[model samples]
Target: MRIAVPVFPGSNCDHDAYHALKHVVGVDTAFVWHKRSSLEGFDAVVIPGGFTYGDYLRCGAMAKLSPVMDAVRRFAEGGGPVIGICNGFQILLESGLLPGAMMVNESLRFVCEYVHLRAETGRTPFTGGIAPGTVLKIPVAHYQGNYFADDATLAALEERRQVVFRYCDPSGDPTAGSNPNGSARNIAGICNERGNVLGMMPHPERCSEEELGSADGRRLFDSMVAWLKEKGK
Candidate 1:
């Protein structure tokens, strides 16, 4: 499968995502600049982590207006799979492609470390290969990674099974202490109502290889590719 990784000024993790998909996951991938208004020929798109637009006007707020994001919104509306990591998740929220908003870490500090994520559901393409309640070791790097939503929104997400992952202890328990950021309900990741678009704060590309201390993140990419192939056939 072919993947497009959109690159914006200050997008530091674009290359890492490209490398993970191209070399580590053995998929065709390309870097799509933020100014370009096309996402043609790509089966999936990844908005990688980084401080976009220098995190000005709030994280992802400025980047959401980029020309490429217009195309990305179109792609997602057409049911094309889209995954946003870290600041990218913030962009999705800003663009109205996903729910909720990001807040400063409750600790008021930049958090850069590996955390365990429990797969809440396997219904979405991004997490289909992962079994429910499975723990994944992934890294998160962001200052404004805390996720928040209204009670009604959270209830709807739970009802639709759109909450794909949650911050959890190594043993798979989602508790207050395990939440790296003060996200509502310990949510680490979530998908849209249609299940095609996903937004998560963790950096899956950083740990897609065993040499990097874990290969658990590969399952997410693999699941997306597998779903694409299945749909194509």
Candidate 2:
């Protein structure tokens, strides 16, 4: 599998994401520049975390207009898999590739640490290897990770089972301590209606290597690769 990791100004974690796939997962990976006009020959793409454009003009507001986003939108519409982490998730929201919006942490702080996430749905390629209700330990670092959506949109997400993951304790229970950013319903991640595109505030690549802390994130990439292979796509 080939994974495209987008690199824009201030995108410090792009290489980390690439290494997770190339070294850890042993998958073909490329660092795609944000100015690029196309995303050809890539099986999947990942928008890694970081302070894109120094988080100016809202978390991902400035990065939304980057040249690569057009290709990303096209790739997603064609049923290509795309994963957005942290700032990348914010970018997806800004790009309108995913629903809802993100706001600053309820306490207005930058949180950085390993967080527990509960798999809320089994329908997405990103979580194919993990059964529903599985617990994953991943790192989340962001100042604006609070996810919010209107009541109707939230209801629609629940109806379609698009809510893929949520902040939770080690026991997979949503609690005040497990909720990192005070997101509505403790939502940590979600997918589009088709389930090919995923946006999450947690950094899965950061924890894919056990030495980095945990291997919980590895299943996410593994599942995606396996899913693509299954379809022979």
Candidate 3:
């Protein structure tokens, strides 16, 4: 399957994502400039992490208006799978493709380190290859990664099992102390109601290699590929 990795002016992780998907995951991937108006011919799209547009105004506020975003929205609405990492997650929120918003870390500092994430559900294409409650060692680098949503929205997410991942301790316990960014309910990642879009604070591409300290992130990409193949996409 062909994957499109969109590159905004300040998207630093676009190359990393391309390498991970193309070399590590062995998928056909290419970079799509921010000015591109169409996302046709791509089976999946990934919005990698970075300080888009210098994070002006807010983390993803400016990047949300990129010309390519319109196509991203249309692609997503058409049931194409979309995954956003770090700042990309913020953009997804800003574009209203996903619910909730991001806030500065509870510690009021930029957090960059490896954190444990537990698969909250295996029903979504993003996590279908992993077992529920499986803990993964992934790295997160972001200043505004704190996820926040209203009580009703959180309740709806929980009710529909849309919560894909949650920050947790090594033993898979999602305690307050394990929440590095103080996301609500220790949330680390979530999927849209249709399960076609995913937004997460962690950078999975950074951990998809064994030499990179861990290869647990590969499971997520593998799950996506498997799901797409199953659907003949």
Candidate 4:
């Protein structure tokens, strides 16, 4: 199956994502420019991390208005699997493709390090191969990574099992100390109600290979590939 990796002006992880999916994951992948208007030939899309618009206008505020976002929105609405990483997640939030908003880190500092993520659910296209409570080692690099949601939305996410990944200790416990950004509910990743769109702060593409100290992130992409392949059949 073919997948698309959209590239914004300041996107630094587009190549990383392309490498992870093409060379590592062995999937046919392409880069969709920010000005592109259609996702006509793609099966899925991955919005990689970076300082979109130099992180001006509040992270993704200005980037959300990019022409490509409309296509991304249309693709998501059509049930296409979409994954947003770091700043890309911020863009999705701004585009209303996902719920919640991000704030500065609790430490009031940029966080850049590998952290453990516990899979909270496996029902989504991005986590179908992971069992609940499975801990994965992935790196996260961002300043505004703290995820915040209203109590009602939080409750609904939990009840619907849309909370896919959570920050946790290596032992798989979601402890307060393990929360790097101090996000509400320790949420590191989540899916929309349809389970096709996923957004997370971790840089999965950077850690998808074993030489990078961890290959756990590959499993996330693998899950999406498997789901798309199965759906095609």
Q: Summarize candidate 1's per-residue lDDT along 1-233 as a digit string, tens digits.
A: 67999999999999899999999888999999999999989889999988898999899999999999999999999999999999889999999999999999999999889999999988888888899989999999889988999999999999999999999999999999999989999999999999999999998898899999999889999999889889981
C-alpha TM-scores of all predictions: 0.98, 0.98, 0.98, 0.98
Which runs of model 2 end up more than 4 angstroms from their true locations?
A: none
Steric clash pairs (candidate 4): none
lDDT of each: 0.92, 0.92, 0.93, 0.93
Pairs that collide, model 3:
none
The reply for model 3, stretches above 4 Å from the true place, is none
1-233, model 2: which lDDT tens digit per residue? 67899999999888888888999998899999999979999989999989999999888999999999999999999999999999999999999999999988998999999999999887888898899999999999998999999999999999999999999999999898899888999999999999999999988888887888898889999999899899885
Clashes of 4: 0
Error of model 3, residue 223, in angstroms: 0.7
Model 1 error, position 156 (Å): 1.0
Model 4, 1-233: lDDT tens per residue? 78999999999999999999999999999999999989998999999999989988788998899999999999999999999999989999989899999999999999999999999988878889999989999999999999999999999999988898999999999999999998999999989999999999998899999999999999999999999989982
> Model 2: clashing residue pairs?
none
RMSD of each: 0.9, 0.9, 0.8, 0.9
Give lDDT: candidate 1, residue 47: 98
Local lDDT at 68 for model 3: 92
